[model samples]
Target: MADGSLARMGPEHREEAWQRLGSDTFDLVVIGGGVVGAGTALDAATRGLRVALVEARDLASGTSSRSSKLFHGGLRYLEQLEFSLVREALRERELMLTKIAPHLVKPVSFLYPLTHRFWERPYTAAGLLLYDTMGGARSVPGQKHLTRAGALRMVPALKRDALIGAIRYYDAQADDARHTLTVARTAAHYGAVVRTSTQVVDFLREADRVSGVRVRDVEDGRETEVNAQAVINCTGVWTDELQRLSGSRGRFRVRASKGVHIVVPRDRIVAETGLILRTEKSVLFVIPWRNHWIVGTTDTDWNLDLAHPAATRSDIDYLLEHVNQVLATPLTHDDIEGVYAGLRPLLAGESEETSKLSREHAVARVAPGLVAIAGGKYTTYRVMAADAVDAAAVDLSGRLQPSITDRVPLLGADGYYALVNQTDQLASRYGLHPYRVRHLLDRYGSLVHDVLAMAEGRPELLRPLPAAPDYLRVEVVYAASHEGALHLEDVLTRRTRISIEYPHRGVDCAEAAARLMGEVLGWDDATIAHEVEVYQARVQAERESQDQPDDQAADASRAAAPEARPNVSEPVR
Candidate 1:
């Protein structure tokens, strides 16, 4: 509540975390700091139980951050008649929009281009009517069937012959990495011991149950024993590897499917409405990201490095060719500003294909004290966490209560709606323009006051980073001081999004950002150099990898960056 500065998780916070979790005992230990894991920790902590959350890398560094950034009920799933998944996701969307994260998540509209005139309109309209009825979808207007003229009017960027008609509908979107970070920050606010860059190397077993995890501080390389009544694994794509860490065969295996997205300047695609163009393999989306468009996602089987999934030349070309079919101006390789790839964990079935697998998650009790959850979508993470907790509570050995997170608001949600009205006052107080203050409000809600207050002594901090003009210098400092951004990549890639937003991919600003962050993290000259070197190599690898023709070539190109200390971060399952 006190500005939510991550400074609380420093040496003192670390000392306190260890005193409780480091003391070899807790009521619950939740592994992995992705959204689901963060949610599980919060659910367990808020229910009057002691909890500890451990992440081998920065929080949300996996699929949670590198997502399509939507919070909508899966519309395509509706086509598949996955009514339950859509309804559940719609309910969560309502909570995030009106109750949970009003400041972070907002409504966004998409245009479904009708390739055929008559049948496509009615068929889509019938499905949308059902979509509108699913849950608490009242905040948005119902879908509207539109004429080709109406559709073209809504999306002026489209060529004349691109569509027969269109159906415009609404969905919600969020800054995924920031939302996940807020979840962890909110968990800590509720007294959960939260630590990142801490590895869960092994499970602590008693008789037949998992009692806790033997964790190693990847930063300091110190081993510590954390005892807990129950352990829940929310490692997503890395489920099988974590199960192996326990030396137990999992109830099922998790198959990794790779999806890649490219970011381009929004001006290249002139459209009033976001476009969802159907492709032979899947749907192609030209969704609006801040000052840019996010064109993505090629789904395919991946058996390579989970930590850094590389996108090859063919994948990029496929996206360009498909998206260019309707574009008035075509986007080329040079048009791309940022590119990212993520892996989804699908429960392996008899079908060896990853795309054919379902997104429904699995909860398994491999050991008496351990429960593992994997293979769910971003919107239903709360459900996955609740289910994981429900499964592990069997071993909790107490009169337990059902999950209350359904009715509970995340930390900023309580007063977020009211704060939206006070943007002018907040702007004046921070000595920034109302629009700038509004941007911060949308990003951090009441937490903007914390970021602003941190900059009170240095008014110069209100200005933008020279290299990454989209972010303030204070944001870099805040990432280190309050948002658990211990490393340069954490600040650029996750905390601030400078890595993908900038043309140089944050390589140019590495030193300047590092110098600013040094004030908070106490980094010396050598450490700064090391961080810069590592980050530069990473950018080089990613750039070189993107030029390769195949996944294997791309992956090899991306691996030139020297590995950090072994076991510094968990290879996302």
Candidate 2:
């Protein structure tokens, strides 16, 4: 298949992919569609190796989509004296900001409030200074100190006695789900067969060596054997399970750590910049999303239901309690628009706290032809990918080329800045506001033209969704036709984030969005209704789960919802 044809992940492309999966022998098979798996596929494909990336559900349906959404060096890690990890992440952050994903990732400022008067200021300033210089390339502004009055003026939402002063620093943020999807698409563009709703059932072994994978189409239950020289397991939280399934003892264990975030209206917090407050266990961030303020997150050990990590009422209360300490007008549960919980696949350590576990990733050649990678932060997925592929090179024939992914730009990255300059022209051409054009550019980057082209004959698609005005109807169509969103929840929750961005949590727009997707995927009225029903039920289950008191109750509540991909089996223990 031509590279361009492979890049489009519509229904037609997915059908072609299934055929290819059954027939073609690839150099590498990536099991997981999170950022790391996608990045690994892209890296290997660019090195002129045939690759296939498979996911059990939608891309980024795991921890990749549920992160803090920042491309930052761990400022707190410096406090832990994890200087090398901090430096590496900062370098990756700079790459995303300037060279790699200029459109998807942009600079976001944060204010670190100083509670103690004298000692806190200089102490933070020193940390900030190290943060500013460590990344090497200065794409963002350096840190600046602010007085109590200055900080209050910048963020009037803060109480008068919340802080003595503040330090403002810059970090970058992106829509995590969109970024991960783009990475997968970029991999496809480079000739990797990227397919979601495809689960790896077992390993393919020849004698004592691993050879390939036996995969099942979670959507339809059709089974296929994909021949590959090496299989890299990038299944974040499910890492150990996959290792065990292969009957290979893993070099390290991965512990699940749950992190929760809540979204509120942007107007609720009168802040010009994001706020970072210290907690006894971890830090809480009040981040400025496009139309909302994203406040999170609690780091706690999670031992139940890794796939559906639930956020309980106690979790919500913990966030509200801490954030309210500094806010002039305290927020209640009623003010929350949405809440989400994700599990971090921490490399388990001697420390009892999940937060203290190592953020550095580990790549192991478990057998002759299989490699497993886990325990890395979202910001450093690319680096983690390179390392995994390098480790798997031992199984491949011939001399493999060194990874050149650092120099490879993702799809839509090439002309992003040029499109930014032509936003007004694009708006005029599309009969849209310049602001809407800019928003589309940030989300789709240089591919905004392709997105707008879909609405050419269909004028109605140009209009915004009535229930979720932030996104245009064309985007829902594009998600199915180009981005490989198979189900309604994939479009609503991951593709556009209408689920967490709106108070209705995408329930109100479910039908409209489903209809838009149905147009692209050829969904009948029955399929559309079924999709809508499942999405609504999922939302209700999440709401019920959030109201529960603890993780076990929350897990039970969340498990009540019908599975979007019912055929996808749970990980084998």
lDDT value, candidate 1, whole model: 0.84
Best prediction by lDDT: 2
lDDT of 2 by residue, 1-573 (tens): 113234789999899999999999999999999999999999999999999999999999999999999998989999999999999999999889887888899899999999997788888888889888897338888998889999999999999999999989999999999999988999999889999999999999999988899999998899999999999999999998999889988998999999999999998999999999999998999999998999999999998887789999999999999999999999999999999999999999999988899999999998899999999999999999999999999999989999888887777788888888988888888899999999998998888878888898999999999789999999999899999999999998899998899999999999999999999889899999999999999999999999999999999999999999989888756
Q: Which predicted model would earn the best TM-score?
A: 2
Off-target runs (Cα >4 Å) in candidate 1 are 1-7, 563-573
Per-residue error (Å), model 1, residue 199: 0.4
lDDT for each of the candidates?
0.84, 0.92
Q: State the weakest 10-residue window (summed lDDT) of model 2.
A: 1-10
Each candidate: RMSD: 1.8, 1.5
Cα lDDT for residue 454, model 1? 75
Clashes of 2: 0
